[model samples]
Target: MARQTSDCPFCAIAGGADAHRVWEDEQVVAFLDTRPLFPGHTLVVPREHVPTLTELPADRLGGFLAAVQRLAGAMEHGFGAAGSLVAVNNRVSQSVPHLHAHVVPRNPKDGLRGFFWPRTRYRDEEHAAETARTLRRALGGSS
Candidate 1:
């Protein structure tokens, strides 16, 4: 088991601190976000204290992601949402250092701008291809 941090709120929740918990198992805990983007928005986190997704052990990834998938479906079926959005903030825009996947219920024209950020096209085809090539190389794949 990973050592729990005294200051991490997610760790406190995992340690049975007060929270509007929705789901739990040996591996994860799902609960409502205090400030939700939507009514049914939930945050899912591993029971163990992992600061970020990259720091989460490979063996634990499957269980954490499985719980996230389940919650996404729940957001649609239980919350009567047209669909759901699942997202993870590795470091940037991550309010808590503890890794958590946000499962948000979604409907058409809910007034939330797409991606919550301005969208822009690549400079051109060559620019796009170059970006892809760089990512592929980083992944140790042929570009």
Candidate 2:
């Protein structure tokens, strides 16, 4: 069920508030990000006022992700971008509590490093492999 609060900006947008809407349907909405990483950066969100991805109902996850995928393609085709960076912030650095996926258009040598954090290398190949193994174990060996 869709929940809209008067205070949440996303909910306002979802409820037909003024925004640069790129796409909208019964399931989700896509709009230009107010503070864009690039000219074509867009935000995709479920119509429901879900605070985070984990809170989004399982049945809605696929459709929401598909909407994000569609927006990624739009970033390339609509803005002539070579590719796009899709990201979701759960809590940390989440400027808003509403769940949103950022689709930032990308080109070669964009100079925007991953989250602008200094890149670091693993101690060695074994160290990298061990990190992957740990994650695999946490995921019940799904990998």
Tell me the TM-score of each prediction against the true structure: 0.79, 0.78
With candidate 2 superimposed using the best TM-score fit, by how many Å does residue 96's alpha carbon deviate from the native?
0.9
Clashing pairs in 2: none
Off by over 4 Å in 1: 117-143
lDDT of 2 by residue, 1-143 (tens): 48877789999999899766776779898776666665656788889999999999999999999888877776676556898899999999888798999887789987787667332455555544443343233223332
Judging by lDDT against the true structure, name the best candidate. Answer: 1
The reply for model 2, stretches above 4 Å from the true place, is 117-143
Q: How many clashes in each candidate?
A: 0, 0
As a whole number from 0 to 100, the lDDT of residue 39 in candidate 1 is 63
